[model samples]
Target: MVEVKLHDIGEGMTEADINCYLVKPGDFVKADDPLVEVQTDKMTAEIPAPRSGVIKELLLTPGQTVKVGTTLLIMEDSSGGSKTVELQKVAEAVNSEAPQADAAVVVLDRPAEVKVPVGVSARLGRILASPYTRKVARENAVNIMEVKGTGPAGRITEEDILAFVKLRDHGGASTSEAGSEQQVPNISKYASEQEVPNVSQRASESKAPNVSEVGSEVKTAAGHETVGKSQDILPFRGRRKQIAKKMVQSIYTIPHCTHFEEIDVSELIALREEIKASGNSISATAFFIKALSIGLKEFPVFNAKLDEENESIQLLREHHIGIAVDTPEGLIVPVIRNVEQKNLKQIHDEMKRLTKLALDDKLTVQDISGGTFTISNVGPLGGSIGATPIIQHPQTALVSFHKTKKRPVATDQDEIVIRSIMNLSMAFDHRVADGATAVAFTNRFAQLIENPKLMLLELM
Candidate 1:
């Protein structure tokens, strides 16, 4: 029997939620056949089978969080005839009794059924903490069984252990003995009861010495002191944690440099308004994506991602743009495939569908994969001017668009007039491109936006 353990899903992913299982027990699978889909904070990845075999068991369930190195599924080698048949029998037995079993079963090679150990309550003389809590206790050299539990199901929580440490330092007296439970005792009572020296009074009572005596006084070497400032301890647990880690890694690994340009998109804005005025439904993001697709043909380098494992750069001929959507949980980028071949109307329809799916959390693994570039817009929130955006890893660049506002700009003839101006900032990896190359690319992008006709042209 071979166990398929959870492998690293890139970007330092240590854990993920099991999204779904593609195959069930007793199903035959070939090498590289997708077995399950797992969702990390960053992306949804489909894990494929390592070898051809019959699935013996699925160790994890959907919606369960699994760490790296945890056994996800077990498969029996088909080479051994009787052994494979025996494995199938074991699998059938486990599946048939799994839902009805009162005790959790830990399946081993042996035929005899062995029950996994149940957790004992700390007050009952054994640690009643979870594996995670036990890890934390071991790191701090605290005995898990000695700590009192304040968690559901009598589990020992981190807060409970910290409170115990405070009690130990304060002479082992319960807070109730200090009068008001919420308040500490007076210095006199505290010092007398705890037998701790009162440094403030002792310093005040010291005799006044001569200047030489004071100068000759010895002092202990200073050790590092912690800055006693409160920090927002956001748990690095779900989607948000994944986004944060990926963004930080991308920023550090890729030498990102942003170049910003203001475009007089008054014509595009007028066109959109006319379309809307005629009772037509369209999104500004779709228009932006169409313009970017045209720009990418002229600047193919921007339509590429770094192939780090091969130590080479991969420039994709096909344009697959990822639209960044802000969901309640976190940011999710769903890709719109084959943008270069799609017309403006098709792009708009796909954008609408993808956005709805993203908001509803109904996006599939295929919808989130194969993005060559990304587009993030803050225009809906009414923020003018764009800022640098981090490149989604492997992708070389990301374009950030700001809200268009009426601003004065000098025309070619040097006459200033009010026009709809929008900020466009393209952040690219400097390691893959230089300033002149980025500037030339942005200039072409600016020209395409300035003249909608240029964007409509099929330039191969």
Candidate 2:
């Protein structure tokens, strides 16, 4: 028998929660096939099979937290050898490299007898659907098992669940075919009680109907309403717990000071319009990132890390900007590396790529690390005035952009004019930078953005 243990994936993680097992007992897997999915503090990763083997037993259950080196499962080597040295060698390989991110994998809920192809015997009842697919089913209050499997090897898919929901909701024949309500998993028990207001674009664009419970009543798909429980509980261990811990650490450790400012972005908006008219498209956040890079060149103090042990603040030369993206899972900040070295188009494209990866929960470790400074653009979500933004830990500063509105403003000539005004909140570690310096940095950023032509001169 070969033992598969959880090793330190990266970032000096001591433990992780087992998200799910891709393979169950008696299933044969090849080398590099993902055996289990684990959620660390920063990312979701999968441990691959070290060699071709038949799964013998899973030592840990889903949602169980195990420390590093804990034996996760037992496997019978198909090669008929169980040398400990061979296991050690393969384990080292799995530890050295970062695990690949795959969020669409499913959980092994319960065993139900399933039919297979000719010459294949019936296996235990197993539902095969991605975490995302299951989440959708839970949101719709539909039992995933009731949906027919159209995916490979009788795996249930998101579309299958949605179709099933539609059929049942519209009073179709499938409603009767679906098992009793007792079999359906309680959506409130498994899903988060707090509605995610700022979920990423992919989740926001989901075609699933809104089945969210409202004031102890849930609106079902059948155009009827049912009374829900007065309260619901959600597990606190995954990404939400990690985020809370980091936030508490940051708030308690760092002496935070926020400075608010408003800038006229009329010219920037017109410039973007002109660019679009010329058949080129770019996001406003891209402009903000590039302009920040130039500003960082002037005020490098904000793009720095503080080391209290050494009593020194190290200013980073490269601009790896972290963009805070809100996902269904939680808040994830994926970094765009070397922003100073890339042009606007490059930065825009890379930012889009990272946002999509974060929404899909496929961001690797390198994608979220090495951020010298972070920026949160909550403007699209409609916080119009200002916010006391929190600085990412160990990093010196963070800036949050709020909604832009067309407002009347006095020009240098004392004449009133309509201008696009956007408010921003900048939070910095007081131990590293004072409020005056933070103001100076935002002023420099505003200068370049207010006059889009100024950015051209700063470009290489």
Candidate 3:
């Protein structure tokens, strides 16, 4: 028998929450087949089989947070003939009984029965769905276990949850109406580019007045809806909890100082249009990233980490810039490595690829870690004026770019002219860099952004 333990997937993660199981006891699996999915503080990773074998038993349940090195399941080697009788007896015992409410059986053509994790209060067997799917169900106040799954191995999907919502709202629609359910709600806007969502209706409107989680809705004694201890609450686990912990640690440990500045991006915007006219389209953010890399070369102090234990500050040579992406779950920062080495086109392509991966929740640990600096662009989300952005811990500085608007400004000749002005907020660890240095750093960045062609001289 081989013990399938939860090893450290990456970034020295000590614990992870069990998401779901892909297979169950008595099911035959090949070498390197994914067995279970675990959600760490940063990413969701699957643990694969060590070798071809029969799944003996699952020792852990979904939603349980466990540490590294804990045994997740037991697998029996298929080549061992000595314990064949015992394995068969165990398998028979598992198959003979009616499916327990704690386990949901996936309908399959094969003889092996796979049991998935059940909902906390589900009395009708188990629920097979990804974490994101479950989140969508919870947000919409739908009982996930009651919804019939139409995915592989009977797994529930986002579309399935939306269909269930429409069905529930209509209260048993006719056969034709149910079949013609094509007007799906737009869920993409709910997860905006910034952490703050700009939806018309909040999740609270559909949620139960005094409910916390599903199956936990409680009514008031007087039959009047009033806010209670658990009214309109969200679960503080997974990514949300991880972000809170880090924010607290960073704010408490680092002496942060913020510097605000405005840049005239009229030239940059015109430059992008010219490039687009010539069949090359580029994002304004790509220009911002490239200009920042050049600024980091001049002011390396802001592109460094403080080693308090050794009483030294280490300036990083390579620029690994982290872009903050907001997802339905929470905020995630995926890094674009070696920005100083890559050209504008390369940077633009890599940024788009990483952002897509982040939005889809497919980012790996390698894609997020090893960041020398971080940048948050709130411009798309409509923060036009400014913000006091937080610096990622250990890194010396972080810059947030706000919306650009055409405004009148005075030129060097004392003449008024209309230019595209954008505000920026730069936060830094005051322990490592003073306000003077931070201002100088932003000045250098503003110079490159104001003059779009100035970056050509520094480009490699």
Candidate 4:
């Protein structure tokens, strides 16, 4: 028997998420066969077999993140006469009918089941982190090479990525010898270039202070202030980490200002009910998409991104509107492409299709990409009447639609009656366009929602 360890995926990769196993135990695979697809934050790569042999055992399961150089499997040597070991379902938990260790498994396709321990490997790959960790490091513009590993066998963990970032962000006193280090120029002294991302890496490597003599907030001589309670440290993980990164980017980069308008959609509600009665369950969101499409056509700035580097506003030709779907995994905005070209029925069907895919975690990268503008509905969540939603960074603007409620309204004849009203909250990048532009966009959309027929009048 020979041990098959995970080889280095890339120069910076320390680990990767086991996306799926192409070949299982009892299967004879040849050299260069794609054994597993592994994912890091930035890319997914395939790990191929080093030599031809029968797969004796699999050490990792799908979605199980493991470090590089870990024992991937035990394989029968090509020159040996051992029979191929039968395999068990990787997803199925090994029964404890026979007393054994935690990671022990029974080998099959033999005369008797042989119990073996598939322990974590101590072999270190060139890098020691999973691809996801490396990806986070790259997205934050932190170099993986600079991070110190703390996982088993001195492997890099997610916390290591965050630590490096924190150290760079909160530049405390340099622990290194000040005399030995080369002095770097202060960033504030120099004008920012078009490539802002490079500035950080330069600062990190140059031993230069970011601003005001390396951030007074980080005083190495004085330790951190004590908190009131004893705290438990938790990693920034999964959906929470993703949300934090986006929120931070949006808040820091976008000059956001919000505007709200109460739209009376009584007629729109009636139309929705009539559509439902006709055996078509279409949502008000579909109506809003069609309505917003008209507004976008008239005022293209709402469908534009402010290209600061070029000092210009990029008006997107396609009206791909993103519908924010709250999935169990996280909040994902699956875009409905070319909404302006599609009618209400088509939009509804696409919405249903994408929503199902999003919930099932089956959405491809294409399904969620290329959103010109975003619409986040608070109606389905059912708690808030209205909220100020943040823009989906670089998109320039987003519309927040609240739940519809019956409210008393005064008619043109001065007669009071109850009507279904919903709030349309618009948030836009103030740097790209002024308040007038955002307001005009919001008002036009509100008009269409109030009278759904107006959306069909100017089709496509």
lDDT of each: 0.65, 0.72, 0.72, 0.63
Instruction: Identify the candidate with maximal TM-score.
Output: 2
Point out the worst 10-residue segment of candidate 2 by lDDT: 98-107
- Number of colliding residue pairs in each model: 0, 2, 0, 9
Give the alpha carbon lDDT tens digit for every residue of 14-119 in model 2: 7888876666665545578677778877777778889976667889987777889999999988676544334334433432331221111111333232222211
Q: List ranges where model 2 is wrong by over 4 Å.
A: 79-114, 117-229
Instruction: State TM-scores per candidate.
Output: 0.57, 0.72, 0.71, 0.57
The residue-by-residue lDDT of candidate 4 on 26-45, one tens digit each, is 45555675566665432345
Q: Give the TM-score of candidate 4.
A: 0.57
Which runs in model 1 stand beyond 4 Å of their true positions?
A: 1-14, 17-38, 42-69, 72-233, 277-279, 307-311
1-460 per-residue lDDT for model 3 (tens digits): 9999999998667788776666656555557866777877677777989986667788997667788999999998768664444443433443334332222122222343222222211111224555556657778876664555666544567898799788878797333432221111111221121132211122112211133543344567778554433445565556666677788889999998889999989999989999999999889999999999999999999889999999999999999999999876678899999999998999999999999888767788899999989999989998568887777887889999999888999989999999989999999999998999988889999999989898999753
- What RMSD does model 1 have? 17.3
Candidate 3: Cα lDDT at 315: 92
> 1-460, model 1: which lDDT tens digit per residue?
8899889866456888775565556554557756776777755567888886677788987667789889999987766466455444543454344432211211333344322112221011123443334434544545443455556534466676566567656667342321111111122211122232221122122111112222233333465333543323334445765677788989889999999988778777777788899998667677778878887887888888777788887778999999999976579899999998987788999999998877755676678878899999887779657798999987899998888888888889999999988888989988777878888887877776777666655643
Error of 2 at 105 (Å): 21
lDDT of 4: 0.63
Task: Decide which is better by lDDT, 1 or 3.
Answer: 3
Q: Residue 347 of candidate 4: its Cα lDDT?
A: 92
